[model samples]
Target: MDPVVHFELPCNDRERIARFFEQAFGWEVQMLGPEMGNYVVVTTAEPSAPPPAPPHAVPGCINGGFFTKTPDMPAQFPGIVIAVQDIRASMKKVTAAGGQVLGEPMMIPTVGDYVAFLDTEGNRSSMLQPLMPQQ
Candidate 1:
């Protein structure tokens, strides 16, 4: 099964949101600059880096980020990101299962392709196709 590998929270004020999570949950938030859309990386556990094990090998813990709200985006609430092997295949499955896939997948520099969707129950979530390692 594709495990939930990451999460995202929308925020109108990046600094305020980062501060809230930092103080309330003791999460470490790193604010990326404007080039990266002012995204805030939230680390809830130790070893703030991605697990050294193979993708999806880590259990029980996942890291996430907060994104600045954009008017063009839909379902801007808190959402979890599930890592998948093939984005196109996953999108097809989502639609066949009565879910609505959002817009086209977007590429995150140094990350991978990502897209959001709405499940049959109306919960919004997202998927990520991680970048492959260089040879």
Candidate 2:
């Protein structure tokens, strides 16, 4: 089954948001630069090595990030990212299941193809097909 691997939320001040999480919950956050859309990477838990983590992160725990809120963006509310094996197939499934795919999948540099959709409940969520490690 696909698993929730990440989450995202809209924020106005990256530094302030990051500092809030760091001070309030002891979470570590890294703010990216303009080239990366000023996204904030938040680490809520230390990944427990691998293998035993079902991949790399501990079960029931996931990391999330923050993006700058903009006027033109759609579905900017809080969302989660689910890791899938085939993003194309998943997109089709989303449509067949009555969910609306926002747009075509976009490649996320080293992360693999990613896309966002609105589930039947009208909540925005995303999917990521992570890049496989090379031998």
- Winning model by TM-score: 2
lDDT of every model, 2 decimals = 0.86, 0.88
Summed backbone clashes in each candidate are: 0, 0
lDDT of 2 by residue, 1-109 (tens): 9989998989998889898989999988888899888999888888787533333366678999999998988989999999999999999999999999998988877
lDDT of 2: 0.88
TM-score per candidate: 0.85, 0.91
- How many clashes in candidate 2? 0
lDDT of 2 at 127: 90
Model 1: per-residue Cα lDDT at residue 40: 88
lDDT of 1 by residue, 1-135 (tens): 998988888889988988888889998888899988888887776653455543334468888999988998778898999999999999999999999999999998767999999999888999999998665
Best by lDDT: 2
